[model samples]
Target: MPRIAEARDAAAPSSTEQHARVGRILEAAAELAAENELERVQMNEVAKSAGVAVATLYRYFPSKTHLFVAVMLDQIDRMREKFARRTRPESSARDAVHDTLLQVVRALLRRPLLSAAMIQSNSMAKAAAVPDTARVDRNFRQLLYDAAGIERVTERDAALLRLLVHSVFGIIQSCLNGRITVPDAESDLRELCDLLLAEWPDSFTPAG
Candidate 1:
């Protein structure tokens, strides 16, 4: 009986160890995702990169949609932390907002294939149930609130933010399609931000 119990114990890891292993696998998937499209990033590839079996990968993420969403959320969380660190009470709100938007744009540009894959995946029936758009809306609102000190941002302001975000997304897509140079895109974004914010000082209010 003691030998059997020992064998069972050997087969199971402590909860702490299990969490650590999951962390490692998620990290490995993120690294792989930096270079591969979300759809093309298979469980086998994640398992191989993570030094785990395909079953192990599935234990962490049961489907490609799950894995892809997890990866995007992880990346967004990291960016949120970075944005929080870079933004300060003393920083010009416009400059802070501009920097935050540019950082997001650069991240999307760095993983263009992954971005395209995510967009395509969202169009499929299986992807319809994912809370991606809700998460994105929450994230963008939080970023704007924190960076711009506009907690009660008006409907007009929210609409403007959406437009800016979509325009920036389009610019990155255009650059990825070889229609515009990165430098030109960057300059245009800065110009756009400046034009948008030029008249905002008169109406802007600091968050309480």
Candidate 2:
């Protein structure tokens, strides 16, 4: 029993350490991408900043795009965590969802470089057929699900959320591409959110 207990304790730290190492690498990549374009970031520099060997970095993230995609995935996880603990505004579900998504858009647009890098990374992942891209898709779908104020999603709910997410993605990209002003984009999106989510339960609140 003592031997089994010792093994479990030892294995726990290994898992924690793995998570820590990955966090450090992602942080380094984010910091580097903050100061440079996505194409400008190099893996060697990230490894140096992360205090890991270049080969170690490559083992975790085989390419620059994979690193950026993982960074973006981490960011989305953070956003979900934030929303999970936040208070629901005392408004209709539509209004609350509108406000939630508007806040997310404003925050993301503040770091246009990082946002573009994330988009680029996802595109590269898709083109390269990176397995992690599937995880990104799942997380993104969850983001939309949470935004729609559904604690438990059904197929119909998921389908609606998927459409809403795609719409939001297209609008945000349009804003990024300079085809739409930020203010216009925000207004248009909020309006669309209000319209589409009008039928959502008025009693619904953020899960937190």
Candidate 3:
């Protein structure tokens, strides 16, 4: 009985250990990418900084694109947790969602280089080729839905949210490319959120 219990504990530790190692790798990659251009940040250097082997890094992140996409997802997870801790009783669901997304945009813009690297990697990735790419989309939408106090998402709601996300991504890219100023990007996002969410129904019966 004691041996069996010990074996169960030993087997369970790998999951925790693996999460820690992956977290280390992500932190290392984020730090290095923030310090330099995307092309210049090497995977082996990330492994060294994370205290993991090069092969280990590649095993988790098949490519730089996968790594940065995972970073974006990590960032979203952090933001979701942060928002979860706050209270905003005064704002409507629409306003809450708008504020949440705007805050996220500002946070990313604050780290321009890192944001650029992650956004570019996300854009270049295909859902079929990179599974994290699809997860990035799903998690981000869930974040917004949660902010809006939405308990369920309909197809129409999902489509509108998808459009909103894509629009925001475009604005971010434009701002990063120097085609738009920060204020302009913020203004556009505000207008977009208002326009889309204004039509967002509180209750809808699914089509037959």
Candidate 4:
């Protein structure tokens, strides 16, 4: 008999069942990564933990990199929802943006192993090879723009935000690598937000 093989496509899930299965796979991968280094994580274990066949897992995630990148995407979605629920209208654009980024940093620090895996995958991903990688960047930018209260984005605003985001990611990588402490990272992020958003309409407000 001819050998059978599953399609090796890491496309986004379409059906409800597929979405649920994908969610389970992400959850399983995240749990495993949290407990061990990325290099130690095994695909077969993730599939067994997720209750999906090995081939099925590969259908959604062609490689460990793709799996973890999707996990980062899932994290972004959760962050957006959390921000919406809190709805801090009292905060200025700079404060909101700073707080949001800090939240992200702290969340990652809480799960160092898993965060390392996700960040490594995200950094390694190429736009052509992992299309969801672009989705991660676009969604994160939108989150920052929303925090900035920028209903309409301008060329200058976009450019500044892009630089600010890149700087923040660098800080995160440094913190993860133990090159900087969390307090220092927090201070650095605050300074960057202040400097980058100085021109933003509501970046600073007079204290009572």
Ranking by lDDT: 4, 3, 2, 1
Residue 199, model 3: lDDT of 80
Better of 3 and 4 by TM-score: 4
lDDT of 1 by residue, 1-208 (tens): 0000110101223599686776667677767766876655767877887788887766566556555555555566777888777626465666667777777777878877766544444333132344453565567557766777776777877777777766766787788788998888888788877877665552357566
Model 3 TM-score, 2 decimals: 0.88
What is candidate 2's lDDT per residue for 1-208, written digit by digit as tens? Answer: 0001110101111577777887889899888887778778888899999998998877777667667777888888888889878776667656766777787788778888788787777755553345566667688777656655667666866676667767887787888789999999988988887777666787554456
lDDT (10s digit) by residue, model 3, range 13-64: 1587888998998899889988787888888899999999988877777677
Which sequence of candidate numbers ranks them by TM-score, best first?
Answer: 4, 3, 2, 1
TM-score of each: 0.71, 0.83, 0.88, 0.91
Clashing pairs in 1: none
Best by TM-score: 4
lDDT of 2: 0.72
**C-alpha positional error of residue 115 in candidate 2 after TM-score superposition, expressed in Å:** 0.7
RMSD of each: 9.1, 8.4, 8.7, 5.5
lDDT of 1 at 100: 76
Q: Give the number of the best model, judged by lDDT.
A: 4
lDDT of 2 at 13: 18
Off by over 4 Å in 4: 1-9, 203-208
